[model samples]
Target: MNYLKKILVYALPYKRYAILNIIFNILYALFGALSFVVLMPMLNILFGENHDVITEKPVLNGLNNIGGYLKDSLTYSIQTFAENDQLKALTFIIILVIVVFLLKNIFNYMALYFGTFLRNGILKDLRDTLYTKTVNLPISFFSEKRKGDIMSRIASDVNEVQNSFLSVLEIIVREPLSVIFSIAIMLTISVKLTLFVFVFIPTAGYIISVIAKRLRQQSADVQKEQGIFLSILEETLNGLKIIKGFNAQSLFNSKFTDSTKRFFNFSNKMMNRQNIATPLSEFLGIVTIAFLLWFGGRMVLIDKSLLASSFIAFMGLAYNILTPIKALSKANNNVKRGNAAAERVLEIIETTNPLEDIPNAISKTNFKTSIDINSISFKYEDDLVLKNFSLKVLKGKSVALVGQSGSGKSTIANLVTRFYDVNDGSITLDGDNIKSLTKHSLRNLMGLVTQDSILFNDSIKNNILLGKENATDKEIIDALKIANAWEFVKDLPREIETNIGDSGNKLSGGQKQRLSIARAVLKNPPIMILDEATSALDTESERLVQEALENMMKNRTSIIIAHRLSTIQNADLIVVMQKGEIAEQGTHAELILKNGVYKKLVDMQSFE
Candidate 1:
């Protein structure tokens, strides 16, 4: 129930539509009950049952008698208006029923019409909030989550929240009001029969509730299975090539089939439970009606105390309440199902972000002096990845890190970029602890070129413009030239405007890597970090990208993480790392002259 209220808070902005829907639902319920009650006077007239028809409206004494007085008053007015002509009275009664039925349907349509805005508005806002939260969450959060699971929350889970919100709202206001209004009319007809009807209600409610007891758990299982299959689909799409190369199609097929099988079983259980509501309510309804017929028959026929016409109208009113009661039963089941979805949706929205910036954090805008890694130690999980690692880079100089895999070369880049916080010690920018700086301000001063050559499926110019949204054509051209990507780019049909296709697959590996460098150059930040920017290329491509890197690094504070020994031979300082600790630190020639770790690495690369 708390989860239900949490989701409802998103309805604040659209409360106007919500209020309007409620008002219309109220009117609809009133007219829906009145639609049947209006025929009572007509039935009385046709049956010649009104023995004392008055010529004027009767006066109401108080609220308690208002229902009885109104019924009597309507009977008198119809009798007077028709001038005691039976045919004329029947004709007028038929017209009144038609008007009442039409108004009931109109209000029903209006309720749904306004409800559309409230339902869909909540949907749009919830999805927007979820997406913004997902994007702003720290990268570490995604390392533990499946991409498809997040997608399911945004797409499927939110949809369920919207549906549940409206279903509960409709049950809370519309259906219950319908039953209440119809029951009011029944009470006016016969306090005896209405009381008998009330006796069965709680019993019916208890039974329906018992049947729906496990619905929430079952619904959650179904929703979770949906997330699992969606994850499988996403993984299959991303690793299709690997699956095909490894001949593991049967493995994925079995996995998908198994997930779907669970989804199938869970769905069957939930739906089979929900399906019991209608018939069960109807059976309960008929049982209550049977009691009414037996009891009321004593008054109408055997005892001759109640009018036959009024008893018939009372029976119709009793049946009217059944529709809403049955509908309420079904809606209750849906809300229980939706409860599971709401819980899943709110779980993500309510999650605590571990990387939130500190209060009064400095928004430093420029790079000055040096970045001092003061004995920083960090870990991704249990074991440490960086152990008391300390290094310094002066402004306008390039320092390259060379190491084998798992040697913490990339961890340095990640820490400096503020992608993860250090578990111990501190990294300070210009002598102020980086934790004091806002992450946005910290990242703004550095441009990163990663090994993957990340590119979007968009125009070359648009992809470069991501570095600086307001950059001009000349600035972009200059950046491209600096990164050595302009020559090949200028030959394309659309040149800078040419679409790169997915991950720039239309271009060669060298071309993609150069575009990544061009994007960084266009940003033109004071610091540049290149993580193996040339390791994945052929010698020709490596030479071209290495030259581009030199141009981009000439006037910036640069930290280069590389595997290819030749790429860092000219770095101002070379730090060779081994197993989370720096094994050597000096210029390339200096390390070689020492005839140690750097010397062996260079020897190995030379042999290869």
Candidate 2:
């Protein structure tokens, strides 16, 4: 219930709709109960059990005897009509039943109509917030979490919460009111029979509760299995090439099949348990009804304390209670199932982001003198990736970092960009601590291009426009031409409007890299961080992409993490790293004269 309450808090904005739904449900319940009550006078008319026709109207006295007075008044009205004409009286009673049922259904529809807004509104808000948080969270957050698990929470789990929790608005308000209204009429009809019903209801509820006891745990297992299988599917899609290349498709297939098998088993058990509620509650209701028939029949036939017409109406009221009771039982199961999903979703919405901007963080608008990394140390988990790392990138100068794999060259780029803050010491942009600046404002001053071309499934122009939301087409074309991408882009089917398939797979590797550079060129930031920007390219593609990077880096304070040392020969300063520490620092010509790490790397690559 606490989980359910947390979900319902989203409904606060739509309180007026909720209130309207409640009002309609109340009307629906009132008319639904009255529909059965109207049947008594008709029964008397049919059985010829009515005693006499009365001309005087019955008067209301006090609240306590209002039921008796209303019954007498209805009988008096029916008797008067019958005296005038029997056909007219029978027609009136039949029309009254139709009108009562018609109003009941109308109110029921109204309740459901209003509830639709509340359910869908909450669903939209939940999904939107999840996406907003997912994008705003630091990149490091994804390193420890599965993408598919997060996707499941946003897509599948939120849907489950909607179906199980939000959809219950109708059942919670309408069904219970129906039961209450129905039971109240039954008590008025006969206290003994109503008491008899009370005895069995709690017993039936206890049995149903026991059946649902393991439902929540099983539901959680089902949701967890769903996430696992989805993760497997996501991994399969991402690594299909590797799977085929290694002929390890069978291994991935078996893993996926095994996960689905568990899901199938858990879902079967959970759904079967949920399915039992409707029938079990219905059967129990019938048993109670069968008992009532015997007991109430004796009161009417033998004891003569109950009227035949009133007894039949009481039986109708008793039967009416069964539907809502069954619904209430189903609703209980739904709440249990929904609570499991709600817990999973709330875990994400409630996660405390460590990288969120601090209060009163200053906004940095431009790069000034230099970026200073002073004795910074950092780690991913417990293993230090960068230790006592120190460097300075003076404004408008290009600095290149060259190192072997796992030597913390890329870690420096990550720290300077604030992707992951240093575990020790500080990185200051100009004279101000980078941590003191808001991330949006801090990132606004820099542009990034990674080894993998991270393009979306969008038009080529739209993809580049992401760097500057309001960039003109002419600006886009100029950026593209500068990155050496305009030649290929102009030849595409739609020119700049051509769709780049997922991750720009439609374009060649060199073309993709050029478009990435174009995006950076469009942003035209003062600081450009190119991390292995041409490492994955062949000779010809590398030549093209290298030219693009050079064009983009002109007059920018550039921090380049290069795998091919040849690409950094023209950099103003070259730093060689080994084992998370700087091994050598100088210009390319000076580093070669030092006969140290930089010269060794250049010689090694030249030999390769």
Candidate 3:
């Protein structure tokens, strides 16, 4: 319930709907109880216990007397009927019971009808907020988490909260009120009997509550375990190639099975506990009803304080309380289960985004002189990847980073584009600290071409349009031509409209890389960062793509991370890195003359 209270902000928008539902529910409760009460007078007349009044005048009190007058007039009419034909009065009582029961159900239906708006309104707003939060959250938040787990939280967990927990609000409010109204009428007829009924309820309630105490925790565990297995499933599908290549299908199979087995065990315990609640509470309610029949029957027959018809009406009221009691007990379990889901969802909504814009951050729309990396140091964990690494790239000059694997070439591109921030020192653009600029504005000045294409399962035109939403067909074709992808795209059945399957799997390795470069080219930013852009291609494809890359680099400040030392020989400046520090720096010819690490690497390749 405390968790529910936290989520109440979502309900504020639909307060009017809630108010209307409550009004109708109150009327439904009142009429539902009154229907049983009306049965008592009808029973009395039929049994000949109370002869109907022959009233000629009525005692009145303002408008309030209207009810008494109607009762008196009905009593006189019944007397007239009984004198003429006794069977007719009996027929009228049965008709009256039927009418009251009809009205009771009518109002109940109306209460539920209005409640639909509030229920669905909460669901729509909650899903919307969850989606919005997912988009605005930082990239780093996803680094340590599984994509499948997040998807499960958004889809299944939210649905559980709605179907199971939110339904309880209606049962808690409307059903309990009906029970209260019924109990009040029962007490009015016989306070002593009602008081006796109360004693049995608390004992039954205590036993049910004790069993339900740990149910919320168990539900939470079950949901979390489900997320674990869902994550494992997602990982297996995404990395199927790696698993098969390494002959590790059995390894992933065992991991997935283990996760599902734990989920199965947890789910079994949660459902078993929930299933027991309904039958156990109902059994206890039946026992209480039996005790009431014995005790109340003795009072009516021997004690002489209770009438036969009134005792019958009281039994109806007692039976009515049992249904609500059982319903509320089941709803209580639902609320607890919902509480578990709500807590998980709320954790996400309440979590603070570590990366946020400064209040006064400026927008950097253009690069003036150069990008400067001043003594920047960073690490993913304890082991540092870059230490006091400094570099400079003047406007329109090409700078290439050439090194062995894990030499922090890609990290430089990441920091310059603000995909990540440096742990120490600063990276600045045109003499202004990159952190001082808005992230959106800082990233807009640069375009990136990674080794992986990162294409979506979308049309070719739509994928290229991602670079610039309002780009024209001509512009897209021009970018494609520059990337050397236009040739294949023009040959496709739908041409630009052709659908690229998941991660562009429908295309060849070279084709996907060309499409990636086309996207960056379409952006046409002032600076470009190519992180081993041609590393994954064959020799023939690399030669063609490298030519396309050179054309795109014209008149732009480019930072290239190169795997082939020969490809960067013509670069204006080549940075040689070894173990997170500068090992050599100069033109490729100068580095080869130095006969250091760069010379050894070049000689190993045996540059002709």
| Winning model by lDDT | 1
Please count the clashing residue pairs in each candidate, in the order shown.
Answer: 0, 0, 0
Off by over 4 Å in 2: 61-63, 79-84
lDDT of each: 0.89, 0.88, 0.84
* lDDT tens digits by residue: candidate 1, 377-409: 999999999999999999988899988999999
**Local lDDT at 110 for model 2:** 89
Cα RMSDs of all predictions? Answer: 1.8, 1.6, 3.2
TM-score for each candidate, following the candidate numbering: 0.96, 0.97, 0.92
- Tens-place lDDT digits, model 2, residues 1-608: 67878888888888887898899989999999999988988897787766566668888887767777778888787767667576778788999899999999999898878878777777888899899988888889888778888998899888878777544764668888888999888877787889988888888888988998999999989988888888999999878889999999999999999999999999999999999888898889889889889999999999998989899999888888877777778888888888898998898888888878899999988777999999999998888888898998899999999999999988998888888888999999988998999989988999999999999999999999989999999999999999999999999999999999988889999999999999999999999999999999999999988998998998899999999987888999999999899999999999999998888888889833
lDDT of 3 by residue, 289-369 (tens): 899989999998889888888889888888888877777777888888888888888878887875567789998888889
C-alpha lDDT (0 to 100) for residue 7 of candidate 1? 86
TM-score of 1: 0.96
* All candidates in order of TM-score, best leading: 2, 1, 3
